[model samples]
Target: MSHHTAAKLSRSIISRLGTRGFSVNISETTQTFARLRPAFAIRNLSTSVSPNGSPKDEKNNSISSDKSQNDKIIPSYWGVAPAKLTKEDGSAWKWNCFRPWETYTADVSIHVTKHHKPENFRDKFAYWTVQALKYPTHLFFQRRHMCHAMLLETVAAVPGMVGGMLLHCKSLRRFEHSGGWIKALLEEAENERMHLMTFIDLAKPAWYERALVFAVQGVFFNAYFLAYLASPKLAHRIVGYLEEEAVISYSEFLKDLDNGSFENVPAPAIAIDYWRLPPDSTLRDVVVVIRADETHHRDLNHYASDIQCQGHELKDAPAPIGYH
Candidate 1:
């Protein structure tokens, strides 16, 4: 193709990609694309890149050095895909750590090793225990606010997830491993029940504030889920977005588990592994397990989108007012 024709085609492709929320710089992405032409010639191109000493292409030269600086100040990449400003998982970690092990004093006073006054020791212990209990409660309130923020932040993603899921499902239909996708959905559905139940069992009257916050979340999430079924194309994107939310939510739970300081987390008997990290002691293992099912869910929706079959089946959205 001629240089003019190729550049025109590149711009057209960039415009289409932007509509789908792919927002890297067109010229830069196009240059990258050209470099990978040989790889795309074969099916199943890897999305990852390895560092290589390839010469700067014409597009890079055309752009000014200040372009990168300008891009950094824009608060977005070409004004398409939105950024996640607050890290909910990191917030969860902070809340969990604000209160470590709960401190309580023994009736029988033990002599202090460093600071020897028994009364002073007892007073310090009491003050710290009261403070510890309040810490988680305060943190929980902050988390509730943040959860609200996330829903607002990701509102635009609704259509994108729905569309993406449909595209993914349609693409996966040719593969024989379709049943696993259904199984993953079933598992997530079942887990929601336990999650609600656990919340009810441990939730205190004061926790109603948090519950109200979650109820609002339920409205958005349930509607999104319904839309997924009503329109699988949209549903796919909704679920994909939900999976991302789940990753953040569960990671927060894991951080709380490590600290062992939830204000009202249930006893082990009430809910097995209710507040504990997954059996394996590594963060990688926890993240992997949490992400795997979501990925499976994403894959299944992708496959579902691929399927040309149709139905108006509806599943009830999870309740908006669960104790959790």
Candidate 2:
């Protein structure tokens, strides 16, 4: 008949009802149970007086509730649990970074390909610039897709941050909102950074490669900032083209992995936790997810360029908040 006993009984009943797929409206159910609490207390008093009402059952139920609570720590996009943590290593759940509305698969197939060609002097310059960088990477990293991905991610994470920062500043200066573009671009930047982090655990970059990341990031960050300032449209178009190349590179990575050219090492724990991947996931699984993210970024940046091409500000259209 105690308050503790009543609370435990209510929880047990609710848990059983949920498991059985009962269509109980939770608020209404709670109210109904609250009204019946007096009856429950009376029943409990009688039951406790009987020989069959063992304290062992009560102990077991309490333990079950504690276990359930311990197991309910759902992970957020950053691979940490949603709840405030009191200690490290307390998270009990894992979830994929993709939002509920986002499709977690690559939009483009390896069979479907596109090659950007020179439409004008500017287009020629962009196309040639990307190709110049791309071929050298292909030559340098040849069969080492992990290193290739690591380097590409370093460059890839730049545009979104720069674009986001510029858009944020413009919004503040103009006293206008950016139609969610700033948040969307920042999220994209963070996602790309996570890709780099995951690859770091998988590939364990050498000292030279670490040095290369610093140099590339430094130069590219400044270049991209200036480029975005000069023409946001062109900057977006360049990123779109870069993402297209990324898709192709990832396609090659997948092919090599599938052909047994690279060891199908078990996926890193960070990857598994971040992507909510199966415990038995491998590097191929991680690549598939990263390639999908790049495809989404490609589509988004190209869409932004199209808006600009049509003589509309990005603020005129709603940004895809969780496209991937």
Candidate 3:
């Protein structure tokens, strides 16, 4: 079959899958999203040899052996088990596992700028969650509030995805710091992607339907803004609020990570351990990094707002984009 036909077939399957959940429509869209996939192809495939004619696995082992002595081996701060430890549980063990710097390299190139959109059941739920938050009625699901927060997180990631793509596109055009920035953007995308999924995993079927409506509403809001670019002052305040919210949510997530609640969230999960090592990288360090990134993002809104309302009123304002 032609590639186009194959794609259409894949999309059709995705649509059918979407209907099983509360969000039938938005699930179809997210299922078809091009940017969400990772880059590896390990299924039903055999390992290959290296360029020098040695088996790839052998080469990898050789390299590992060479570096084993020089590589800093440290004990895992948390016990090796994946048991769910709560906040009031053993503090020392939990804190140790959270050490951000001790983490091994989190290879992210597997999905960055590649042709795969990672599929997790959570994507459909996330799309629906966004829809749910868009409506006033769904807000009535009060105790289901965590579902709403998750939707906000997934929606918030859209801009960052765009920014990441822009960075990549820019790199292609200029070939300057493109590679490094691409890596960073890809990592950010992966992290946000997992964050969205975690929320979906926690939500129920009914919540998914409410979430779908909310996602539609969010789309409408964006469309409305397109015609009426928010005033600089209004935009700044709005962006500021969003950044603050992101900071708070991520902080809570980090705290949960420390308590071992994060581990229960499941994998292909985006633990800080995915990229930054624990013990050396510590959860506190990760939190601090995330906070700094959010602050910078918030500061951009302040500048954008100033430009919109003050007519370049703040000469000292930061550049309006390239946050992170």
RMSD of every candidate to native, in Å, equals 26.0, 17.7, 22.9
Residue 154 miss distance in model 2 (angstroms) = 1.1
Q: Write the per-residue lDDT of candidate 2 for residues 166-217, one digit (tens) a residue.
A: 9999999999999999999998898898899889887788899889889888
User: What lDDT tens digits, residue by residue, belong to model 1 across residues 1-324?
Assistant: 899999999999888877556655788889999999766633553222223422232232221223322233222112222222222244222121112221111111211111111133433443353345335444655554233323322332343343435434644775433333333344444333333443344433345555654664566556665665565644543344344444445556556556754332324222323324433334333333433433444434433433422342212222111111
Better of 1 and 2 by TM-score: 2
How much is 295 displaced in model 2, in angstroms? 0.8
Q: Quantify all predictions' global Cα lDDT against the true fold.
A: 0.39, 0.77, 0.45
- Candidate 3: misplaced stretches above 4 Å? 1-146, 159-194, 197-210, 213-224, 227-233, 248-268, 273-295, 307-310, 313-323
Give model 3's TM-score versus the native structure: 0.36
Worst 10 residues of 1 by lDDT: 103-112
Mark the regions of model 2 whose C-alpha exceeds 4 Å error after superposition.
1-118
Best TM-score among the predictions, by candidate number: 2
Give the TM-score ranking, best first. 2, 3, 1
